[model samples]
Target: MNPKMSSPKVGFLYPGYAAEDDYPRLGKMVNPNVDVELIITEFNEDAHTVEALSEMGSNRRIVDGTKHLVGKGVQSVLWTSTSASFVRGLEGIKEQIATLEEQLNVPASTTALAFVRAAKAIGAKRVALAATYPEDVALLFKVLLESFDIEVIQFASKGIITAAEVGTLQKDEVGNLAVENDCPDADALFIPDTALHSAEWIEDLEEAVQKPVLTANQVSFWEALRLTGQFTPQKGLGTLFKQELPKEGELDVIKS
Candidate 1:
């Protein structure tokens, strides 16, 4: 007889700028019991500007993206757009999540929301930020984090508008961003944007910042694990992966 399959599938409503950017990293980071699936949404903007990412989170667009993943049997779905969800305001972000759960009929989340969960998991009250997003977009992300009662001790937005440019950032550059932007009061440093590859530099960046390092792709993927109840520590992925939480808990998608 063939061996039984026990993997729990999780869906990602990935924005276009992050098109196919995080799957490999996720696959490497998750346990064998968790399966990763992607459903690319309509995001025409190549830039990480507030206007561009915000448009991508329209109810019509995000709902349209989940159909395929829903059919794939995902236990939970995550809107993997970080900046887009918080670009406008928290109320819009709340409605976006409500619409997702209502339409998809499953636990739903977003990278912006996941950052909060990841921070809470590590008990980080104050976090610093480093981002490839423009100054305004980065500030919006900070606002969302602050809504969760997480303090923004320091922030450095690269003011780079395009994901194409962010995608081209070097490891040393991200490491530098982490160190340069981190504040002594911060318990963690967050690097938002799945478009910029941080999975490869997480450990090194954490060492540079001397605090836990959370990134877009890493937190979103880790959120999937929590939503699906796949509570396994991912070795070598950084402190976020090593978060020690209760063995079981409700999915940290959206409360409102």
Candidate 2:
């Protein structure tokens, strides 16, 4: 086992209560010594539409969310919403990360950037995306990945309109989504949606697809750990965690 960091703490500015519990669960399962703090950001609407997501990820809302994490001594923070971040595109996401780092005075990233980093970490050239957003919204993630040279060989969108509905999904449904959308030519399956609970089902989903399953919540936490330099290969969290992070400057897609 890698030597644990002494009381390392990471904060997350999550949008709502859907799968927020995954962070604490991951802390316990991956490394109990690391503190995982979550501050729920308020949103006007929980819909998966672009307009709603744009509003949810606005700089004001993000800065407001950081109020609770200011004095927590967190090493890094992550905006744990894939659609919300990706909807802004790469430049927009960069602005978002800048806003986060400025407010918290720590290295910060978002779930959208996390997906790209995770894909490069595993050396996945071709990936299959299984998104829970509408086709238009999901296409933004494809664009974001392709910006980093990760090909989207197969894209599948569930067209779910609300985070609340996705939060209600159970393991079986989440597993089937991965298995069904997986492609033989793809190096990994990317599921983008922090509202869904996927940390506990990583092993089963990877087994079913016989490939890496990169879910939103899973990558979000992994990105937070990466920021703190506390990442170690852990069992049952799928191939992303098991692989070594890309060496500094290897994949310079996003400079968080």
Candidate 3:
């Protein structure tokens, strides 16, 4: 409600069981003027499959959460879960966004789509995945990225099923994971998990791996700002914010 603290609010409908402890850390790294607020919804930490994620994602909790955030003066909404959106596939995820926008009258997006867009922005044709989800869940993400023409050169399932557990990782540990899992042919390394906090050390991770490292939480924030036309190149979040994207989603250094 404090006008000074809250301008350009970005609403995130985050999963319930998964802790969004990282958003605050990343918010501090962004423009202090923008407000990043999260509304938690139902999620099954034990259910790491597509069916489970889809069912949970289909529940009205997303719409309910969006409404709650909009009341808090958020101008945009992002369903901040990768599995939930991709489990439903491309069309289903787009439908989710449509429904969110129709109900809230604000531009909306999901973590899966955000990853795709983020990768495209950097011209990442082949990426390596460092996922906290199981292999099955990670494969679903792979399919989703492939839908956007992004190839997963390598993917490693950390086998960390619960979001609560992934939330326990420190920034250094997260950065090590990004660097360790990066494959030779990958143009970028992707660490997707709202539960995992990567923004705290994304810049360092990029330097360690010698490649762009994208995280779900980071892109979720970036995509939200872009959706609201409030995206600016900021420090600490990662390389994604350090560059600009052309009209075709290619970075200036890359020609499509």
Candidate 4:
């Protein structure tokens, strides 16, 4: 770690086939000063339904994995799987984050909630969505983003049902879907699935569409930056990371 870098330990609660290298690699690209450690949960082969994802991230499993990361001195913990986190909706997401904060004694977040904050960071009101999740899971994500005031102008997905399949999806396919689904009138384009391997694709896709592209893992890194109070804007990553959130206690502004 560089002496001048702010070394905040981050915990990632991930699902099977978790791509650990991509996250820190992406983090360094956006902010080279952070140290990210991952704690993966056990995800079964069949994760196509809300019930299955909920079971995969049950209190017992998440608490166990989260405690291990807390033991390692992480200051913030994030549940990095969109399906596992959003299967419960916004309120459920809130409950899970609260649980992690209480059990691990650290600030916590999930990929879905991270997306909400990420969109707000960039001052985005209308967004286009892309996903690799099953239809039900993707709809849940859409509903949650809407709760955070993001209007879904357009939507598309690959319909990948399994965690393994989502993990193996090609970068080209992800970027293509984003470009195709993104609306010209939308303020930003969002791909809210952590399993989609989006770190390498976000920059190019943003250029292809000429708009801000947000992926679940990218927003996770962005949200971690905010929680740590390190808000330096970086270029070429995306509009969200390149802009700061509104100041504390300011009235929220509405976009037309």
Candidate 5:
């Protein structure tokens, strides 16, 4: 067993209308240690307008939010919003990470980047995706993932347009989407919004599809584990988290 030291503390910067239950589940999966704090932001609800999507106060607000957690001695911070991370474009996500790292002087990454990094870390050259966004938004996400050399093997969008509705979606609906859109050749599957709670359904989805089922929440959790150099096979979450920790000679993707 890994040494039972105090687990790392992480702060999650949530965009408007995000699920409140996710951070605790992440702490439970990390197990025995690691604090997870939710830092929610105030913003408009509709996801259709550029003003709402751009979220004027977002960039600085996230930095200030994370700094609050860092002051509490949190080891790392993650911005856990898909629309805000992706809608502004991939470079925008990079800029967000840059902003947080500069403020807290700690390692930081956005959920959008974490998703891409996790896919590559697992050697997922071909991947299937299930999104709750509309077709146009889903296509933008597809383009983002493709930039990382992970091919989109199959995709299906739920056509949900509002941020609030996305947060309230049922777990069974997400599980069904994972099962239906899975592709035989895909190395892994991804569900791409932190607002949508998917931590509870990943294992079942992996079993049905026979591949690593990664959700936005799952990868964000995984990235925090990497930041703290903690990797243990966690049951009840999914294949990705259930993966054994790397030994001395093994290629550690989390480190690399």
Candidate 6:
């Protein structure tokens, strides 16, 4: 890391208010040297339906939403909603990142892509998913993971329809979901939903399952650091943060 780059500022184009607090808390916990800025994107509805998610992640919406971060000096920007990004599939996410880079002039990625990279970083070839979306939406994430050659050994869907409702789940509820859905044979347990709070529960959740726990907000923040080349091993955040990313050509599934 560059000497001046010790304190890097990362921007996030988040969808709504659900669990957005995780960013600042993460910045503080990782090291006092990082800055996390967020610009909440506009959306017609918070529902997890395909139509709603498509609108939320549309190129126009993402580009327009990220305009505020242009002059903020953010080293990298991330689309922080997992469901919205994955709903568009791999090609659509590539377009989203391209548009954001064109508009913001910085490295860009999404939470959906972040999960794949984070998993690969930790050598998690097989993972179990515990999603807050309905079965249909949850399956899309499975397909997204499989595209990167990562297997989804077990799947659990909560059938929750809105991000607002998911935001209300307490720590115990979130932890229970992860612990219950974890597969013993899997390398890690993945909880997909930016709305849910898992940043503070990473250690406990990992202890509960005796395996790595990858959560949306947690991986999204870690991905931002990876993009800026500022990743340093951090303790208590779970296995993903402790692992080193593969060299440039090793896992270049989606180029930053």
lDDT of 6 by residue, 14-119 (tens): 9988899998889988864579888899988989988999999998889788878879999999999999999999998999889989998999889999999888
> Taking the tens digit of each residue's C-alpha lDDT, what string does model 4 give over 105-205?
87778777887777776778998887777777788888877877789888776677777777766878776788778899999988877777777767788
Q: Residue 117 in model 6: shift from native, Å?
A: 0.4
Instruction: Tell me the tens digit of each residue's lDDT in model 5 across 1-256.
Output: 2676667777777766556577777787656656887777666556744456667336866765765565777677788776667777766877888887888776788777788777766778889888878877777788888876779979888888776787777877777788888888889988887778877777778888898988888888777766666666677877767666444533322221
- By summed lDDT, the worst window of 10 consecutive residues in model 6 runs over 247-256
For lDDT, candidate 2 versus 4, the one ahead is 2
CA lDDT of each prediction against the hidden true structure: 0.78, 0.89, 0.79, 0.75, 0.74, 0.90
Candidate 5: regions farther than 4 A off = 48-51, 244-256
Query: By lDDT, is 1 or 5 better?
Result: 1
Question: Cα deviation in Å at residue 99, candidate 6?
Answer: 0.8
TM-score to true structure, per model? 0.90, 0.96, 0.89, 0.90, 0.88, 0.96
lDDT of 5 at 236: 82
Q: What does candidate 2's lDDT look like per residue over 1-256, in tens digits?
A: 2664375689999998898899988888774456888999999999999899999999989999999998999999999899999999888899999999999899899999999888888889999999888899999889989988999999999999999899999999998898888999999999999999998899989889998889998999888988887776777788988777777887567654
Clashing pairs in 4: none
Q: Is candidate 1 or candidate 5 better by TM-score?
A: 1
